[model samples]
Target: EAKASYWRQLAMDEIRRRSEYQPNTRRARNIIFFLGDGMGISTVTAGRIYRGQRRDGSSGEEGCLSWDRFPHVSLHKTYGLDAQTSDSANTATAYLCGVKANVKTIGVDSRIKAGQCHTDKSTHVSSIMAWAQTEGLWTGLVTTTSVTHASPAGTYAHVGHRGWEGYVPNNCMVNDTKDSARQLVEESPGNEFRVILGGGRMNFINNTENDEEGLKGNRRDGRNLIEQWMKSKEGKSNASYIWSKEQLLSVDPSTTNYLLGLLGSTRLPFVMEQDKNCSSYPTLREMTEVAIKILQRGPKGFVLFVEGGLIDYAHHANRAAFALEETVGMDDAVISAMKLVDTKESLILVSADHSHAFTIGGKPERGKDILGIGGYSTDGYPITTLSYANGPGYNETKVNYTDAETTDPNFVQKATFRRYLATHGGEDIATYAIGPWSHLFSGVQDQTYIPYAISYAACFGQFAGSNCHTCKTSTG
Candidate 1:
């Protein structure tokens, strides 16, 4: 009787939600495209359950993520130009630049090959960020990874290899290509960013300067790109460079039109490892909040990209707990952004570049602890709720884990095969969206369709001559 009533309530809730849904066709005044790198379907399920379990001792199957409630959702094909499985650089290029490119390549079309610098000379494909800037919209990028990393670099840098953050790959087929940092800072100073915040301070500063965390610099060249960036913006805009949480919090968003914040030398601390009591770095939520405040000051509205890059990092390391923590951290940022923006004039998208080969199965009963080990296998060995197809945690000897610890933050779930790092899954990933033509995201779509959807909703490129002006006036 109770189960029936519970299911009935859920059905009624969904129906009410659909009944209240209104499709907004207005041209978006702003757009916030949030990418959760390597956040697969299984990852989302586990993260949702983990988030619910952490809140209270209950079966987390009933819990819903912030984006899960989004008005429209669709699965996205993550294949690249050269392979079924995709890397971040290629996948980012497809969605951000609106075209598919070879693996490990950024901001270029399929004609360019990875590691071929000379071939990329005239193949630079502009991303939506550039389009937004040209359309008089402010642009910004926020990520837990380095700003010059594959995902964020797709927005501006036209590098052949994703590894060329501060140095070129020795095996590169060409030599004249500059590193990603050089492209971001030296090549295009600030690149019209209203707010830029994330890690990878070493990529900008020189070897003589120690990062805020006392980490040694990795820049091969003696140039201090951070100093150059500051000098270029000294008399032009209200620019500020911040490296610590104190500095970030002290900035007045109203007066500051341009801001650059580097939270770590490489990647910021994982949410699970962060010192919530006295942390030097700000949380992803805090970063997003500050970014929106600064970007919102623009008269033409803004387009911001926030990435949960550490989720992919944790999955590569086979740390399920850490990955789920990062996903939840991303959800918090989405919630924060929701409160700060109006749904009528803004478009918000949450998507993943690709997926990890992580799995969440064991078939535990309802309300079971998401991170706990489930019942013993037929061989009398306990199995965890989370596992991988291949990873360093593979149990080659078939050891029994009836009493083994599986709930630690650093615990790596058992895998089927041995690998130093778990591989990415070729499976389809999800895209969730709301506001301004979000209804177009209802069916399975190619990865390239993402940028098209955003462009169509915001009236960019071919859609610039669209009926947006009339639609906006009518909607308003």
Candidate 2:
């Protein structure tokens, strides 16, 4: 009963705090959108436990991650125009471009189908980045995936096929349209971005050319886009192009007006796989800090999109440990931004494109390692606390437990199906918000409601005409 007073007092304080709460209605001068790719509610819950365990070696069930502390939260359905479950491509169109497109399409309306090429600009739907620029707000994007990947590409590219990032195959023939790499370097909002960071250098360079690490690119077109991006920024801006961790962190945001860092040839290595002391790429948190430092220098304010894209990649491989770790890494980035930006006039949004077919079942007890075995199957064989609904892990029937290393990083949790890769889940995802207009984020919403809500919060797009003249900024 000694702890009852402590819990009661905490509850009373929280009640008092909520009872006197006033929503911040001030015009948002800055907006930061954080997308945790394929981060479902399950991922967040498990990630919270994993984070607490890793940090304090405790039971890790009671604590919350950084964004979990946000004042407003909502659950949003994540379905594409054609598919019940969504991929990053189509969903990116909704969340970033504010329009739902067909599966595997990006930045175009539902008129564009996946794997098809179109020459029409009429079907194109512009992203918030473009809208932010229309109002002269500085814009940028950072991701663990290549900057040209689905979510980032949604901010700029209007391609019909997501796989056409590097090259357009003969059958898929993207000859009529620009590939995502070309779009980033040659397009309007993309070329004007002050900061761009991530992997997938192969899509930006010629197949004959080698990246900084001697990795050959995959682009059949002989054009070297990285050099072209540099040339575009020459004299016009104090642009810094870097390809290593040391170079990225060394960049002085005060001196550099434009930044581009392609740290990997494809998607970045999963966080757990990177050597902390010698890895050449910065963590998502490090990239976020540098991006913010540079982006916040705008006179008209800025909007930045930082994506933890590798979380999806880890889940697809049925690596629950890595997926949860990536989520925690993203939480670190969110925590860093919270300290760097003033929440009174700045709006920070955290959301996901979709979810993976993963589960955290088996009813393990308190303080147990999240990745450890939770219970035994009907046959008396051990099963893990984390397993996918479907994945490559079901290649064989299980009869062993004594020789198993359930906690190993390479451990692929069991799956029900024998697919080559896991699939996305057809379920609702959550969005958490803080700062200006954050209260509007509560309740169930469609996935496309995200960009519109952000626009409303920041007073851009249709809401640019919005005024907060009577609203006073909160000091507390």
Best by lDDT: 2
Q: State the number of backbone clashes in model 2.
A: 0
lDDT of 2 at 132: 93
Write down the lDDT of every candidate, Cα atoms only.
0.85, 0.89
Candidate 1 lowest-lDDT run of ten: 467-476
Q: Global CA lDDT of candidate 2, please?
A: 0.89
Q: What tens-digit string does per-residue lDDT give for candidate 2 at 1-476?
A: 25889989989998998889899987789999999999999999999999999986778898899998888999888888899998999999988888878899999888888887787889999999998998989999999999989989998998989988987766545444689998999998899999999998999999998898999998887889989999998887588889998999799999789898899999888999999788877899999999999988999899999999989999998999899999999999999999999999899999999999999888688878888888888988887899998988885767564325878878887899989989999899999999999998999988899988888878788777534233434586
lDDT (Cα, tens digit) per residue for candidate 1, span 1-476: 26898889989999998999888978888999999999999999999999898865557888889999899999889999899999999999989988888999888777778876644456888788877776788889999999989999988888877888877665552555678887877554235777889999988866777876787777766778788778868777688999999998999988898888987899898988888899888888899999999889878878999999999999988899899999999999999999999988999999999999998878677877777876778877788888989888887687665424688787877888899998899999999998888898988988988988887788775566544443444433
Error of 2 at 361 (Å): 1.1
Backbone clashes under 3 angstroms, per model: 1, 0
Which residue pairs collide in model 1, if any?
59-367
* Model 2 regions more than 4 Å off: 1-7, 171-175, 402-404, 466-476
Question: Any residue pairs clashing in model 2, and if so which?
Answer: none
lDDT of 1 at 256: 91
